[model samples]
Target: MGHRHKNKKLGILIFLVVCVLFLHYCTIHDVVLRHAIYRMLFFLPLVLGSFWFGLKGAIFVSISIIIPYIPYVYHQWNGFYQEFDKFLEAGLFVFMGCLLGYLSEKQQREQEARLKAERLAAIGSAVSQIAHDLKSPLMAIGGFTKQVTRHLSIDHPDRKKLDLVISETFRMEAMVKEMLDFGRPFQLQKTEENLNHLAAECIEISLPFAKSSGVDINTEFDPEITVRPLDSNRMKQVILNLLTNAIQASSSGKIVSVRTKREKQGVALDISDCGCGIKAEDQQKIFEPFFSSKKEGTGLGLAIVKKIVELHGGHIILFSNPEGGVTFSIKLP
Candidate 1:
């Protein structure tokens, strides 16, 4: 796609250069009428550039046209009135380009936004149906596995195998729950809550996982950070999800840190890890639904986190740590 776009731009540029050269160099009788006809032709490239590449393209093409025309105008210096008229026409070319470019860019943005909305609607509907279908069977399988595991003696040869089955069943159930949560619309139940306390609680909840993974969890809460309106449960989910991901990404004996700090907007909750960081190419798509770097990830965790944060009038930012790993910052307003 990128290569195709580059090629298209090159073609347009070549065409524009050809048009400019023709206007300046073409030999014909009746110079004034000929120049007028070809000058009007400059608008074709201006319109094309504006529609294809927005303001920058329009401005660039207009400047390119004007530069060559300036030399031609000097060579064809007839009178003061003629020179003034020519310069006015050049100014009009730039003005037309700017206007067309602005309108084109606005149209493109509106179209993109509309398409994104339609795609998300379709995905939500499909995910809701699939999650609903899988929910009951997953529950049944998990229940039966648990019952069978209970019937078996602890030292039985198949006990460990049954436990593994139970574990996998639970994992699938969790994935299903993630899908359902993502498909549903967000309705934030907001109340004023301490950011520091919330971060501490999420860190505590993630402690067990961190320990089992041989990773250490750390926290730094700013004393000056105050309470703010938040959907406590949803916020907990966001924090826990981010913390768990950080812990999982970290190596043994590595540290995953959670911090809360006061910011100009409101407060920021940051989760940073000392593990291999995300690839630069994948960073932009990290929060996109069903886009994951993990082999077993459902890829909905970050998407849901972003949704919940935005619902509360906040935004999430991801940064690559200098030493290692990635930092996810939830900034609230």
Candidate 2:
């Protein structure tokens, strides 16, 4: 991950350096190469940067090129309005960069969404079949273990081991449920519900476990937010899974903060925890089923969360800090 990041930074630096050098050369040689077409050549790199790095990259490269070209433009004309016209020309360049960069980003995102939908469609079928096949056997095992425990006295020699077996079976059952949940087609039964109230319910459910581990749970819901149409049950599941993961990630006395806010685009829910943060490489794989960092983790929690968010025409963003903590923000429209 470090190597990849370093390489990306190097590439951006090299691009900016080359662009700056070209602009400087043009400025110094303006007498021989000062055609209007020559001044407009800067847009080539600006467009390329946007396609390569997105809006901010395009704007940054535009500003870098404009700085060198400004002095040349100033030396060409002495009138006050002429200087203002040059600034307007520079502003046009900036606007072009922003527009092209935004379109390129939007296109890239659409392509990614198409690819993700295809992948999910392929995987969901196989997972559904597998979960269906495994469910019956797991239920049988759980039933047998419970019956055995009922027969055995609490002081029986095998009682503790049998109890452990029952617990393990229950855990397996939960995993199976998650598999089915992720594999099946989800249809949101939307109704008007307050996001803050849903969050409070999730917090209430997770509070006991948090307190047991000496972790603190905090909430900050926007007072101005009102009831909005959403899938109450599924949204609640998303909140609970996030809260549970945060609680599990933190150590004693660490704080987990959950917040909901109204944004111009939609509603946003942020779940953050001061815990042992995720590694850079692992962060990308966290949403892949069965890719877990924990000894007994199912790794389906976040995957399910992501699927649900996407189903609702929303997106999830992960901000991971290895030294500090991680935050998962879900935006629902």
The superposed Cα distance between candidate 1 and the true structure at residue 246, in angstroms, equals: 0.8
TM values, all candidates:
0.88, 0.70
Candidate 1 C-alpha lDDT tens digits along 1-333: 298986788587768767666765875525767767778888888898888888977998887877776666677678988578877887788999999999999999999989987887889789989999999998998899888888989899999998898899899989999999989898888899988888888888888889999999888889998788888999999999999889989999999988888888788889999978999999999988999999996999999999899898899999999999999999998
* Candidate 1 local distance difference test against the native: 0.87
Poorest 10 consecutive residues by lDDT, candidate 1: 23-32
Best by lDDT: 1
Per-residue lDDT for 1-333 in model 2, tens only?
288974686476457546655755556544644645555767777877788768976777877776766666556666877468657877898898898889988999999989988987788778778889999998999899889899988899999998898898888888889989988988899999988999999899999999999999988999887887889999999999989888988999899999999999988999999987888899899888767888875677788988888888899988975568899999988
TM-score attained by model 2: 0.70
Model 2 worst lDDT window (10 residues):
28-37
> Deviation in angstroms for 317 in model 2?
1.4
Query: Residue-pair clashes per candidate, as listed?
Result: 0, 0
- What C-alpha lDDT do the candidate models reach, one value each? 0.87, 0.83
Clashing pairs in model 2? none
Q: What is the lDDT of residue 302 in candidate 2?
A: 85
